[model samples]
Target: MFRLVVACVLISVSLCDDLISVVVIYRHGDRTPIQPYPRDPYRNASYWPVGFGQLTNLGKQHHFQLGQWLRQRYGGFLSPHYSERDFYIRSTDVDRTLMSAEANLAGLYPPKADQVWDPTLPWQPIPVHTTPELEDNLLAMKKYCPKYNSLLTQLFKTEFFLNISRENRDLYAYLSKNSGAQIASLESLEYLYNTLYIESLNKFVLPDWTSGVYPEKMAPWARFSFATQCYTEELARLKTGPLFNEIVEHFRNATKNDGFRKFLVFSGHDVTIANVLNTMGAFEYHCPPYASTIMFELRRNSSFYLNIFYKNSTQVQKIALKGCDFDCDFDDFIRILKPVLITRKQWDLECQNSNFGDFNTIFIYSSIAIGFLISISLLWVIIACFKQVKTNSNDYTRLAIDEVA
Candidate 1:
């Protein structure tokens, strides 16, 4: 049976035709938890080497291995020597993600001959581009979108989410009391799970309360909560739109220009991966694991087509966009994704009008300034009137004394 399956796979690849270009979006590898629970015993920064929320040596290795895998898989497509024109890399403005991109680039492109600056160092520095964290919308996590938040508020009020919230009420209360957090939400659970997961990996002994069935129950809800955040079509469009537009443009350009670049690499967080996958209508229920990747391959057979592959952790699975087959045709793929392509105006408006109250802040400051000016003018008028009254009174007293003389 194994031989037969292998034979079929080989035959399918043989029939699939030529690879033109590749775009990959991947999650950064394992790292120290970004933060600890408020009441956790190990809350001190002294416990970690680089302090809170930094990538560990293990995370570096994970990304390095991924780079090697990319090298192995795309060896036939990419040039043996690195060319500035052939490859591009972008990462989120975070230490872990930036470092991961550099590590991955190291595996993808190693120094050779003239490209080597030093005889001792085998690796060469590859540039990874990034924007400011506050300005990032492509990654979707830290972006403040009022429209998206409004959608989430409505979603939370739905019967579906209400049931989930009510069912997990006891669990949330227990977590809040133990973790020293007020009003535990889905985000809190995610952070809590991350802490526990990382601690367990580090060989720390967890409390007996998390021993067997408790963790099992908590894990699913946490994952479900994350998935629910962008569950709706509108929310998904708003959150994932920028990224989807970029990927589609890359595909379109690759086809139009006959594959301008060999590889377009994006290094980002798990939320980044989930948002893109969800936008494609290919997302599974679980949260995206560390070091996961989704690849879009532009292939040219009789004409241009796209092949989408997802690696959740270890295995690569093929996924299709909605209204398209596994190996989606270029035209059909473009049409299906058209509605979610983020416009420049829409993104700017969302960023400018986020739920954090940009308009309200301007109004409040302006109102205070205006009120202060009006009060100053009123005080000046009253002082001037009092001085005039005193002058008139003095003149009248002098006139009376002269008449009496």
Candidate 2:
């Protein structure tokens, strides 16, 4: 293990002639939740001005720094001057992800020559192509990450049961009104919220609305479903997205690929970063916290052999992968790549959810359940009134009728 690591270190320390292209998959900066549940402690919107889980200004700086590092690392390959042909970027159409790409480009390119504006103006916009989250080009889902699936199946199975719950249905009305969405379930709610802010940044706030404490009595899938949705969205996207195909084609036609793509930056979420590594056969990285990024460093050996170094961009900087020597065989690399992404959720389970206890979980979940039920009951009572029901199809109308009728 140590020898392999040494080899990776050596690879990072030098450049190889065989190194032609780079693919960097990165996570977007910090963000807040889309909004708080009415029961949430942080629901008051004061919890975050950008509002829970949205990117802060600090995150912008981080990407800018990374961009500078990239410019320094691949000095010659990329043009000092702006040419549309020189660099290409892609994001997941999320606000933070796309914006981070823009930030990184700002630092990397620095708006050379005619690209620069007034002395006061800064950070020229760089193009970062993207597709919808469900339609993102580079994505994968491992069919068999035991822990992730265990949590997932539990989540899905639990959500199936939640559909029958009175509380969930009632709460849906209140949230639906606020979000202008029909959030029938947690996954739907999460998707609605995740995309809304990812696409419309200024409209939302960033830490998120999570109270960091769920209600005391939680429903079976209440906690699990949100987690599952977060995990599964990437998986579903990967299999169907164009990114994997793009990689396959890129390797197939190496000489035509751009050298200036020193880093194949992918601005996405932690789940995205984790799955990309897992898809590529580095099944060891599990992401924790918001804006977690997994780094894949590609370099050439002394003998001009190709290699890879996998790092999770975190405080400890976990090395889940070592020298992935392709030995000039793209086929070998793809084989490794496919499995790593496929099983990423398993690694995430290890890195993030390995040590949960019954007592704390029970307390947390119970509190959530109690809060959810109370709010739901309030909505339900409002919905239950006949006078409003007779005049309108809207749940909000019924809620209003409760007081009048």
Top lDDT model: 1
For model 2, the run of ten residues with the poorest summed lDDT: 209-218
Q: Please write out the lDDT profile of model 2 over residues 1-405, one tens digit for every residue.
A: 336645544444333234555666667765666554444344566646575656778778778877776676556555667566545667776788777888888888886668788667776766778766543334423233334445555555665555644556655565565555566766565444454334334433333322121122222334234333334434333332345555544444444444444445667766665444444444442333344555443333342223444434434243433245434345445544443333334343442432344447856977999999999998888887866777676535356447753
Each model's C-alpha lDDT? Answer: 0.78, 0.52
TM-score of each: 0.82, 0.54
